[model samples]
Target chain A: MTTKTPEQINEDLLRPLEGTSPRYLAALTFFVLVVLAGAAAFLHQVYAGLGVTGLNRPVFWGFYITDFVFWIGLSHAGTLISAILRLSNATWRRPVTRCAEVITVFALSIGAMFPVVHLGRPWLAFWLFPYPSERGIWPNIRSPLLWDFFAINTYLLGSVTFLVLPILPDMALVRDRTTGWKKKLYHVLSLGWTGTPRQWSRLEMAMRIMAVAVIPVAVSVHSIVSWDFAMAPVPGWHSTIFAPYFVCGAIFSGIAALIIAMALLRKFLHLEDYLLRIHFENLGKLLLVMSLLWFYFVFAERLTTWYGNGSSEMAVFWPTQSGSYAPLFWAMVVCNFVIPFPILAIKKLRTIAGTVVASIGVVIGMWLERFLIIVPSLSHKYLPYSYGSYRPSFTEIIITVATFAGLAMLYMLFSKIIPIISVWELKAGEVTETATAPALARPEQVRAD
Target chain B: MASVNSIYGLFADPDAADRGVNALRHAGVAQDQIVVMSSEPHEGHAFSLLDHKTIMPWLAALGGVVGGACGFLLARYTQVAYPEPLITGGMPLVAPFPSAIVTYELTMMGAVITTVVTLLITARLLKWKQPLYDSEISYGKILVGVLGPSGAARTDLENRLRSAGAEKIKTTGQL
Candidate 1:
């Protein structure tokens, strides 16, 4: 570990915020264009109605729902992992926590957009909320979709707080360093932080509370998301095992996303020195564990279904195993398990680049997993004649691509606005290290006299 | 003792700041009157004035309870308010399971929001008027703020800070 002087740390952390390079502008323009294209496609879908996307009988939910589940699963990357690591007192998490938390906020925001997008009358999405209306009937409270609303909104609120709170001191730092409009903006964001003892105390206390509180919220969010499927009467969808299974998959996918994000940031932001090898190795180990756990869950879920021998469920299962969706299913297994296992498990190949490679596969695999899960079961619902395949239309593909571009663009924007690294937290880590080292060296130093 | 005076001493080294804070205390500066501001949080330092009491714990709990209550009301009222309450899947009118989901989410949301608000109020954030501050704090300097002692003690405080290796010391009128 490098011991950085406060001046060195300040300069390093604030480098990204100094000025936008030409490359940043170019990347931003590309993403913006992608976003615009996506918006146009979505508008086309709206103008043409839900028919633009392939929503035939028995397979109403398709790519949009898959994207919804994928992005929401990705949202688990930040708050839950960060909260867990923070509560556990992991020293290595200082450089990582903010990045992870940003993912949660943005992914949740993007994921929440889908339910509306998928709703045929998209503008009337507010009907989902419990409100007094001309229609005498309320939206069903017994529905898991309603549960999803409450859980996701709660998680988003917690995530926003979790992301913004630690940023105050750093905002104050920027407020002091800059002049003109940027300074004015930062001044308001910093909230008059004078760094008094009380400020630090309250900050630490709030962080601890958030760290503890957000974990359950994070867990509930994915569980509720899983319940969206499990609560249904459809064969493959209704199972008691779905909650933990989905939560595990969510974390599994979430960590892979975080790793990929960190690697990209390390390269583009030139944070190679700070976001070191150790961080990747540590995260790679985590990915490996999740991979193993994921393999186990997949095994358990599949084994139980195959053993039960229920023809209705078997119809849904066969497509994923050796039938129509078999290719995608096997690809998911390879990506989530096969590709990641050796690369992450073996220390030699678990370099930054190696982990990124594995993460790429995992991302693809997890997305395929969602696609397989939603499409196959929806296609093979009880009636044989109703059983039909679904394919994503051009509009759905365009919008899905746009969401990825949007995520990149948002992250770029956030990086420019603030120090993405938690500068104060890193310094705090250093301070604690130095502060505690002396006591360990000289036990008699504890004397009050 | 002519009048109460406020002073700031800047140090590049954290240990020097620590000693300076102790020196001010020995010179009869009350613990609450001595404020140490650093670019980072330095734990386990002998800076008693940095101690602060917070009501955030109570505030957050209160927020959670309120959120839980609101959640229950929203779920219940929506169900009952419907003039034509359609029974879906023959489930009861007010299902506790689904209501609990809303309640749990709202409870957590309330706690997080309340804690953040409490942090804002306690830290006195976003105020138009800036407080006494040093730009060097951002450049990794430790600043010791000595508030409201007489001129003689302020002079003694200045000497103490200077002797403890302060790079610069600035004295101002009473804050």
Candidate 2:
């Protein structure tokens, strides 16, 4: 690793925030336009009716629900990983934590929108809130969707707090270095931080508490999302394993998304010096573990379902295994397992480019996994007379595409506004590393790689 | 409130800052009177431990207990308030299992929020008036100082800091 002074680290990390190039503006404009199109499509859907989308009686939940699950799962990338890394005291997490946390905040905001968008009268979505009203009715606490409303909101708040607390000092650094209106903007954002020992110690204490607190919240958020399906009597959806299965798949896809986001930031922001190859390799190894875990869950779930062979369950399973959904199912399997397994398992193939390729496959495969879980079970009910098929409408497709563009735009804007890396944490790491380097060089600690 | 007549010293090395703290203590400055600040945490260091004890965890737990009680009451009161005929068929009012989910979420929310609030209060965040500060602290320097000392004490403190290898000594605000 190349050693950089504190000044160099600050300059390199803050460079992206200093200036906006034409290419960046163009990319921003393009993303904005795509997102606008998505909003327009949603508006049209609202102006029309549920008929505008490819949704029906038996197939009530379609692309919107699938997108909801997929984005929520993707949100597992940041806070969970960062919290776990911090708890485990992984030193390399310094550069990667902020970017990962940013993803959690942004992806979650986007994911939370789908439930609103799916509503026939989204304007009345506030009814989901459990506040007292003139009618004296409350949101059903027994319902998983209500649980979702509370869980997702709590997670979002916790995530934003987790992301913001550490930013105060970095913002103070910007406040000190810059002048004019930029100084004033950072002044407020920095919350008048003077870096007193009490302040630093308190901040550290708060972070410790949040790190311990957020893990269970994250796990429960996905578990609650899973319970949305599991609580129902639907054949494939009603299973005890759904919670763990969803949580594992969530972390799996989350790591993949984090890898993709890091690659982009490393490329665009010129962070090659900071976001080193070792970070990617370490994350790639994690992805490999999650891949194996994901496969195990899928295999176990399928084996049980197949062995049980209840007529209603097989009715839903056969279509996914050999019928109309077979192609998509096989594609999901290949993307989630076959492609990533080899690329990640072999050390030689686990380079930056190789992990990115595997991550892309995992992202797609995870989306398909969500879609297959929702659609096939809903479409193939136990009663043959009530059986139906579903496909996404142009509106659903446009909105789904828009969500990705929207997330990218938020991420780009966030990178420009805030230093994407934690400057103080890096410096702190250097101090500890310098202190510990000689001890680590002792013969017993040296590894023969 | 920021103290007036503050004397500050900037040191490029934490060890020098540590010496400054020791010198201040030796020169009759109380441990509470010496203020130290740095860009990063120096855990287990003397300056980090000075005046650093906190009650944030206990307070956050109280917040969680309060929030959980509110969640339980909200769920139960609202359920019982439902008109007798409007009750969902056969299902009992105020099911413990479902209500526990809301309780858990709100408990976490309350704890997280209270923790942040406690940090702000204890750290004195957003206080526009700050004690003797140096922007160079952000550039990998440690700051050690005595806030609002007497005129005679200020000179002695400055001398101690200079002797302790302070790169720059600064006095700010009214004496």
Q: Please give the DockQ score of every candidate, comma-separated.
A: 0.50, 0.44
**Model 2 quality (TM-score):** 0.96
TM-scores for all candidates?
A: 0.94, 0.96
When summed lDDT is taken over every stretch of 10 residues in candidate 1 chain B, the lowest stretch is B43-52
Worst 10 residues of 1 chain A by lDDT: A436-445
For all candidates, what are the clash counts?
3, 0
Judged by DockQ cut-offs, the docking class of candidate 1 is: medium
Q: List the residue pairs that clash in candidate 2.
A: none
The digit string of per-residue lDDT tens for model 1 on A27-133 reads 99999999999999988888889999988888999999999999999998999999999999999999999999999999999999999889899987887887777
Q: Would you list the C-alpha lDDT of every candidate in the order shown?
A: 0.86, 0.89
